[model samples]
Target: MAGIQDHFKRDANGNVYEVDFKYVRNHVPLNWFFEHMLDAKPKPMSGAIRYGVCPNEPACQAASVHSVKVCVKEDSWKCFSCGEHGDVVAAAAFYWRITHREAGLELMRADVDMLKHYIPPKPETAIERDDSALALVLQKVAEASPYPSKDALAYLGGRGISERVAREACERGILITIPNDAFQAKAFLTEVAGKELMERAGLWKPDKKAPACAFRPLWFRSQSHCAAEFRLMREPRDGEKKAMRYGGKSPWIWEGQTPDDYMLVEGPIDCLSAVEMGSKRTIFALPGCENWEPNWFQMMAEKNVLMALDPDKPGYAAVEKLKPVLEAFEAMVGIFNPPNRIGDLNDQLKAMRGLI
Candidate 1:
């Protein structure tokens, strides 16, 4: 960390000016600045600071608190949930909503060695992971628990999903069901996923040997099938609170080819509903409000985007945060709501079919 008093030189009239960009960028301790400025918590082991509140999605409830992390070594910050990342100067600009030059000046003025309380901790030992093996195991799990099973079809029917759409989703391998019988699921995974792979892939808990999704029967896979969200068929029992188990980062669930316009929805069900409703625009479904990726901006650049997220607090908040981000990438942004003030796209499908 640079000393606070050395960077600025006083003129005859006491006007302070910054020395250079290198001094502000390299000499300042980013961790200390984030700690003092954003009230972030330092994770010494990771050599990063977790933002106390993510500036991108301040009101978001789905993503865990402090989901945005700033790497001390790189002096860069990234919000994992919103996919917003930039350097220390950009961080200041985003937080204060100011120009880059103004942010640089602010950094220069606040230049101080505050490393007394912070020590850069060494990185943790690298874990030898076989991602290919994990993908293969998940594929086997999906194969073992095929979609359109009795319970899954029933669940889809109750949700007002057309049989045709459900069949198409099954063909795409986007949806599957784990065996309702825990013993049966365990036996199958023990052979297919194996104990070592499951543990290493974080598909199994450290204390428990069985697959994490053993009891979670409803499975929703990403388009690439690299990640999955395991959902419970029924409400969680006593002493169990979580209704979903997410494995790996969620990928965008894409539908339609290269269309000029794109419609963004909350989940796969809504995506299917859009297709069933005869929507011609390309559809990209995020696993949830917090899962939008930054790289998607490139694909959506100079294109029209419609946000059809759920008509709820979290949904609206996410849109409010994401709309500007898309716009910044030169994507035209619009908001879509269900007709007759229905809940979501799925509810709209139910209304369109007189199933509500």
Candidate 2:
């Protein structure tokens, strides 16, 4: 039998070269071990994989009792009976009784059909951005839209943004309020950007005729006008469920110029609040807490980043995920939860102005 021992002995020392588990798993098919090493057949299932009895007959005798399912497409498996579940490297480790690292290295060196060189999957082609369309839409909104109405200004005043600042923001094309009249909003969008361009820009759903700008405050990203974010300022009507915030197709990132120092906040509103409160440091505002991009680290390399995300679970979790990436780029990262036991930067601004 071509067992594990015939191939190699276990390493007692921690001197083996580390191999990427993802790379090994990507190259090695799960069923190859069953067919080549254990000489067991895996019956094909209706999906992208096959299932058979568990191969670890000696340990649990699960093979005779339940099915061992293998998803060849994902290079993963689960033996429902024995409760054994893992990816390709985990499968190898389970069979050989070695560490996952050891199995990964072994699979890398094995003479089976596994590729000697790991070829990463080609990245999905990026769609070319229609900057002209975005610019035209923003320009039309600024020129023709009768936005930031008295009610909109009052909404900003309620949020602690001074009337003067709100007017200035609107004039600067940063603050735009859509009409509460859905028909007027849809007509304005269709006349300004056309329905086809709106759909392509992700400002309108194909199945729905209503533009995303209806009855919402649209905040254009300070850095690039390529994207706009919408937030509902009122409660949902009866039986109407709606997300609090959403955006156009493009992701938005606020650009800043303060070298080696910046503040990161969630949402353009928070960014506006911080700036309106006389925050001097450059601010990089994401569209939302969950919208942080890995590529953002490139800009923060060797920089001092102060994160003022929402003071909630998802905010802290995003900070956690971002800290390591920023640290890897040699950036000094610090955290700032909303002070006074508040929820977010905007809320803090409200508290400062005695609105909360």
Candidate 3:
């Protein structure tokens, strides 16, 4: 890792003036910067410092490789490598390819909260122990009915899922139902039995209101098991009720240990397909396009990344936005366009069985 050091300057009276830099590069917006400077190409000084270079400026014949050394002193900075130097604000402006005022505005837009200013220190006697509440929640979930493995098998069969795949899902215990009317005795009985069975399987606890609806065997050791909470729909006075578009916020996936090379997909089904096909390192359905957290990508960037997004406009758009971020961190990126007829890995798996 490159080391970073804070540089500061002092005034003639010995008071600290401000941080200093050896050289300042033009400031460019992250998107534009990635497009023109970081996309697909390795810079000459990939690991070395760089400075501003105006395309319209006349070339300096005396510039040499050794001429650029990044210097940050007070508000001034210079790059010996490119013989480019300027004040701190100037450097930022050049680096971002923006004006000094723009840089200031950008800084203002950044939201940074200092916890020290508002958060009080914990009391010395404050309890510090494993969260027993989590355990109770798990117990409640476990107490819910075991996923309707048989029902899942029936549903998958109706959808043309392979018998083998259906069987695997059944054996894995991957189904649960939401109670449409909690007051109904049948619903309460089902919930009670399901919870007890799940608890016995070590899948859930009673402390949590949301029960585990899916049985993920790996979660016993890795916490990879996921559950979904559904809102039971009842017939409206005028129309039939239907389940919501997708399960509300539920933990339906688990992240395995870091992998050296991974596949990126848009849905959990694709992830399951990849896993079945022996690709262990995979990330499924990001939080959302704009919310793809940098920390998660950084973890994946440590290895080769294959973009296996759905072959659709939304998928393509996601890749377009994500490419630069991955490339900036020097990750190898490959686009995996599955067959047009097959929407994702699971579809591919089904096709292999001649179901499609």
Candidate 4:
């Protein structure tokens, strides 16, 4: 890791934000940083990490090489034969084409590297990425109208949701508040990303589509009111009334920036509840019961995660499916059963607060 000292700077608004690259890099575990080294499976260490032949070195994977010692329990690996082994920083430096020092520096100064002229990612160069037009429209709408409206707030509060949670829900796209006039949403989007792209993004609802909207020709308007399908306030089948269906890549909403521990809860609202009650550094909101992504496990590989999915059938099934996957990483997996099948963590919290 970069051994440089931490430095701080103040923004125009006098808000002090952390710019301590070396310090942040030091905190990230070496195994986690160099996880790419474990990409190849010499032999599946089911529920454990074993020292075997090196996958990175082709000569090692084939035979008589007991040179690799992988401490799955410790999240570390070593190849004595080739003398190539280390934590995430060393592993990243080793594999990366650039100089070892450069790779370490890049990892440490990640935030500063994102500046336009600071690094690659030019039009015809380093990085390539794709974006869904529909998703873009949603992003644009979110950027413009981030805060929840009075109606949105009241609607959630009426449904036993708190004001703080209602605000978070709107900001994260878990819930949306759109103008009553459909044209307002369209015109607002058109003004943002222009007409041609918006039309091509499939704003007009086709009759044959899953949700089956009659006329949703405009982009922003269609997503005027939507909610992620997390069963928080009540059962998903009964409680969730929003028919707004969208498809694309969505990540778990995290209020707390740290990735150390995750209090995996069913609904984003439940996550909010956990955060509001001071579990802010340790909880993450799962989008739905069976909505985990493959990369999510690796993302939380080092975390001490707690699964608090609803105790209902679907929720239980989700937990069963995920338990083994996490256990494979040697994670301490625990099931949190809300009393009497009353529902998620939020429900229990609300009951305790006498808000229910």
For every model shown, the clashing-pair count is: 0, 0, 55, 5
Question: Which residues of candidate 3, in runs, are more than 4 Å off?
Answer: 1-139, 142-148, 157-258, 287-291, 339-341
lDDT of 2 by residue, 1-356 (tens): 24422334345774444466766665576667665555555554324444554444455353222333333434667653344668877777877888888888777666643443423232223334466665666667767754576766677778987777666667667766666566877777678668877666655667775865665545453445666666656554532222323334333343345666878888777877877777666677876666666776677888898988886655777788888888998889998753465778888889899998
Report the C-alpha lDDT of model 4 over 1-356, residue by residue, as the tens digit. Answer: 13333444447996544444344345544433333334433332323444443423443342243323433334345553343555545555555555555555555554442322332111212111123665565566667777765654554565456788667666556554544334664465567655544444444332322221112211212222322231122222421222323443343555465556677776455666676556655566665666666656665675777788776545777788888888777777766654554657767766766777
Report the C-alpha displacement of residue 171, candidate 1, in angstroms.
2.0
lDDT of 3 by residue, 194-228 (tens): 55554443333356443333322111101223322
Between candidates 2 and 4, the one scoring higher on lDDT is 2
For each candidate in turn, the TM-score is: 0.60, 0.56, 0.40, 0.48
lDDT of each: 0.68, 0.63, 0.42, 0.50
> For model 1, what is the error of residue 85's alpha carbon versus the real structure, in angstroms, after optimal superposition?
21
lDDT (0-100) at residue 217 of candidate 2? Answer: 45
Per-residue lDDT over 241-278 for candidate 1, one digit per residue giving the tens place of the 0 to 100 score: 23443455555455676577899988877887887777
Best by TM-score: 1
TM-score of 4: 0.48
In model 4, state the lDDT of residue 196.
Answer: 48
Task: Evaluate residue 169 in candidate 1 and report its C-alpha lDDT on the 0 to 100 scale.
Answer: 73
Model 4, residue pairs in steric clash: 30-88, 33-88, 34-88, 51-70, 263-283
Which order, best to worst by TM-score?
A: 1, 2, 4, 3
Q: Which pairs clash in model 1? A: none
